[model samples]
Target chain A: MTQLVRVQSFSVSSDGFGSGEGQSLERPFGSLDPADLHAWAFATASWVGRREPGGSRGLDDYFSRDFSNGIGAEIMGRNKFGPQRGPWQDLSWQGWWGDDPPFHTPVFVLTHHLRPSFSLTDTTFHFLDASPEEALATAKQAANGGDVRIGGGVATVREFLAAGLVDVLHIAVVPITAGRGERLWDSPDELLDRYHLEKVPSVSGVVHHLFWRD
Target chain B: MTQLVRVQSFSVSSDGFGSGEGQSLERPFGSLDPADLHAWAFATASWVGRREPGGSRGLDDYFSRDFSNGIGAEIMGRNKFGPQRGPWQDLSWQGWWGDDPPFHTPVFVLTHHLRPSFSLTDTTFHFLDASPEEALATAKQAANGGDVRIGGGVATVREFLAAGLVDVLHIAVVPITAGRGERLWDSPDELLDRYHLEKVPSVSGVVHHLFWRD
Candidate 1:
């Protein structure tokens, strides 16, 4: 099978905002609390933060369980890595994912300001100042035969999506609208020109809009 | 039972647009086609335009069936009545819905330029220059014991929605996005303070967002 560039389990609000304005360490999603938006995934059995037993089954659980499946590496924006901007101030700083980060594979962070690579547990972080194509090339190499996941902070996903590198995208559209934030789409129909779209509404009230390029 | 002022079977794109820009006689919804946005309702057995037999019999059909349930009168913006704007130069032009209007009751047309009220089949068109509250009150009186429907033109819906006069609002969130045109809400969450909401995704891919006042 050809290695696909995929986006999985990315959550966006009903009004199309990916992350709200003023993203910081304390508030990762800025004004729009991701916790509220991501309640569907949080209630799933396969959620990373699930400490208690017995989570939801079916549609939501399936997406959560398949999050890391068939994907080797992740390519995300600088903001998704952390809140630090304009040249990394702290060399000691790592990602927001804590001690055992989610991705067990190589991760690429897109940024203008470069930082030395570091490893935490099974995940390794590599900072690169490269075009979307170049970054994908690097990510694909690390991905090996497995597919590459385009993890997002909105801008990164937009960049890669605009470059026409994304193969399959799955966006979990939450019901709430964040009045202010960076929008993932002016309209999801913008992608319908190139990709076939399928909107699957889960029992949790989240509609999973899946787009795939043939 | 309390007489409700409801917005039933109103359609909006995924990006929140009620209609597209450049609305004219030929294009009532401007860029966004109401036919496409209302495909689910059209496919149902309760569609007004249905000629032959056989139509979908699911959630979409339920909404279509309930379109005229307790609705005794309709209050619509000038645009919804027709493409004509400003001073009504054409007195002969009845409406876009032909001789037999779908609304079989008193229809209050909100416009600054008033026209002599006329009757077509069972429906009567009454032109008025009134505020949302005033129009609604008039419609309620005309409706008798039945409910009044806030028929929309995007701007009119926004006005009634903002004025807090709407009792129950049903919006069909279609997957496509009309990038331009009038937006109904910045986010659906804006009305959460005043109303309770339930988003039910149908088999026909239309998510019906129902909001009701207590």
Candidate 2:
């Protein structure tokens, strides 16, 4: 089986902003409310860590559930891991996720300041100061022949995409637009030469755009 | 009936550029190929002045036909009329369209340098050096209570939209991205507060985004 690098269920505003600016603990996705951008995923029945029993079932739910399907390891930016800017001021901050984190596989956090690895539940957080290419090689080995997911916070995804390392990218374009945020691409058309793109709009008002290489 | 300003079958690349820069006679939509941006409309059976007999009959065809329906007048930027900038270098340049233009209604061209009005068949080209509000008033009068159509060249559509004069907008989001061009909006979500938005994806890999104010 060919090992694939995929971005599943990543949400972006209509204007192509993945997250807002000044992302911090109070504002995980910048000034924009996380609920607005992620309501589609959370409303889905298959979303992990759902508070209620019932959620909508169908296309949204199907894609939401696919987030964790084939991923053996995950690679995320430091911003996704926490709000700390430069050096890790506070080691106690495991992540925005509580004690029992979602990912059951090894999750590599890309950062300039590396730290000792730590484990919580089934997920182990490994800090790495490596380029996209270097990080991908490490994650691919840890993936154990399975797929590796490029877990994003915008900048990381853009870097990997610029490096032409991502095999598949599924972006959920929410109806709302982020006036100011971390932009995914100055012009997404820059990738047009390298990838085959498709758009599928769901009844929930979100357009699911898929990009892949043949 | 209430006056409605609608944008029908307007296409844009995934990156949100309606048209590329340096638009000229040979390159209608600037650097971007006209066929690439308008293939969806041309393939439709209802596209006006299609030389060929046969075309696709489906959702695209439906939207293509909707372009002229109920539209009594059109408001467009000077660029949509011709590529000549500053002053009209040639009065012979009627429009990119041949003798029989698609718009049978009075078409208002917004320009700083006004020219005498002329007629071709049932369509009349009226050049006006007026603001968006002033131009719309003239177009509304020519519309004779029928709906007005905002024929775009990106900047014109953005101006009308920003002015909150657009009653409805149907933007066809093509799969390909334009690396550089005139952008419609920095973040389309700014309109979310005023209009109800919806996205409908078609089989042609284009997402039809509809925005309406009640």
DockQ each: 0.01, 0.03
Name the regions of candidate 2 deviating beyond 4 angstroms. Answer: B1-214
Q: For candidate 1, give fnat to 2 decimals.
A: 0.00
Q: Write the per-residue lDDT of candidate 1 for residues B1-214, one digit (tens) a residue.
A: 4677889889899888999998898988888888889898888755766766666534465467567766889999999998986788889999888888888999999999998999999999999999998998899999988889999978898899889898778888988878888999877888889876767787677888877765
**Per-prediction CA RMSD (Å):** 19.6, 19.5
Best by lDDT: 1
Give the Å error, residue B28, model 2: 55
Candidate 1 chain A: 10-residue stretch with minimal lDDT: A53-62
lDDT per residue for candidate 2 within A44-113, as digits (tens), equals 7558778666665445654676677668899999999989888877888788878888888999999999
Score candidate 2 by DockQ.
0.03
- Models 1 onward score TM values of 0.51, 0.51
Ten-residue segment with the worst summed lDDT in candidate 2 chain B?
B53-62
iRMSD per model? Answer: 12.4, 12.0
